[model samples]
Target: MASYELNAFDRRFQSISLVGAIEQVSPYTLNVGYWLRDPNQLILYPDLVASHPRLDFLWEKTCFEIFIGVQGEDYYREINLSPSQAWQAYQFEEYRYPETMPPQVAYDIELNQLKRTHYGLNVSLDLTEFMLAHKLKWSDLFIGLTAVLETSQAQQFYAMQHSGQNADFHNKRDWLHIF
Candidate 1:
């Protein structure tokens, strides 16, 4: 398992930190977890967080995202995993452009809320299925992790690195280096 800690784009949300990890369970499977850490005990204020079994537009609220691709290639996939157990997957031919390739795959998502302070989201994807669907095999992988957080008082974006002043998580620069 490889872990990642993220800093918010803005400084006002300093009390919260986004922690996540990627686990290679098998050649065909990958497990991912995103944890929201709030040590300030600020759970009761701006109570806009939630979890539900939704299908789309999860990025509009507090959500975790994963962008993955084969090294030295433009092809990639964007995965959205929400705290509510909702998932969305999209393929891209290169950069931010969408690719109408293999159909989106739906997987069961697990949600664990620990002590009303930490939010844990877990989801495993069939990496082999995706690789075959995208014609990517036996290649080193590159990945990017990010999150969008919305509370009663504010909405914030966090990523491995800030890409621009506008706070876009999709930027390849915002993604962490290949692991």
Candidate 2:
């Protein structure tokens, strides 16, 4: 398992801490967890939907994100998870180009805990089809973990590392976890 303390691009939200952990349960299964420690409930969370539907634009609100990329390759996959039980996944050719391609994988998100001071989520992703489609193996991939925290005031971005002047999560250089 690998643990990372995500850095917020905006220093004003230093009181809030976002931690991410990821592990490979099997050759094709990846488990990820995110814990947000916000004592003041400063972040906005969407109400959970019963269906846990897969939807787009979850990033417009507070949400978690994952980026999967092959070593030394420009093509990548992005997955988004929301507290609202909504999710989205997209395949990008490079640097957010080629808009999106249908993602090939199964995923499950469990709300581990939710409260005024803390929010937690666990995600399990099966990457069998995705790996096959991309001709990739577990050892050939890198993972990027990120999140967007939206409050009434503004939105803050969190990532393992930020390489650009702006919080650009799509930058492959920020994907530091080799899986």
Candidate 3:
């Protein structure tokens, strides 16, 4: 597992530190985990009882995101997982450009808020299948991990690397390499 510490696009998150792990659970499964310290410091949306429909913009509020792709590839996949355990996955042919995703694929997410100290979300997906659909599970992969935080006063962005002189997590230069 590769551990990552994210920086806030906005300085307000100075007291908030986001950390997580990304690893291959098996040839077919990819496991990801991200934890938010001090859950009370942000205004998170209410949890949903079931999975959300695909393509919903959960990022508008409080949510966690993962961007994956083969190294040096312009096309990539993005997954959005919310504290409510709802999720959306998309294949981008290019930056902010959507492509047709496979008709069927398995995606899973487990969400939890641990009292007042932290909030954690764990995800397991058939990345191998997704990769196969795209091409192959290349030996070298890159992932851009991010989270959107909402406070009572405003919304903030946090990512592997800050971009756009703003909170633009879509900047490919900010994605982190993973194997």
lDDT tens digits, residues 108-170, model 1? Answer: 222222112246567777666666665654347777888887755577788887868788765
Ranking 2 against 3 by lDDT, winner? 2
List the candidate 3 regions with Cα displacement exceeding 4 Å. 51-55, 99-118
Kindly indicate the candidate among 1 and 2 with the higher lDDT: 2
Model 2, residue pairs in steric clash: none
lDDT of 2 by residue, 1-179 (tens): 99999999986768689999989886778888898888777888888776656777788899999898888888788888887767777777678887544444334322222222235777877777777767788899999999998976789999999989999998988989996
Ranking, TM-score, top scorer first: 2, 3, 1
In terms of TM-score, the best-performing candidate is: 2
> Against the correct fold, how does model 1 do in TM-score?
0.76
For model 2 the local lDDT of residue 80 reads 86
Q: Give the lowest summed-lDDT range of ten residues in model 1.
A: 108-117
Candidate 3 overall lDDT versus native: 0.69
TM-scores of the candidates in the order shown: 0.76, 0.87, 0.81
Model 2 has an lDDT value of 0.80
Candidate number of the best lDDT: 2
Q: Can you rank all candidates by lDDT, best first?
A: 2, 3, 1
Q: Quote the RMSD, in angstroms, for model 3.
A: 4.5
What CA RMSD would candidate 2 show? 3.9
Error of 2 at 73 (Å): 1.6
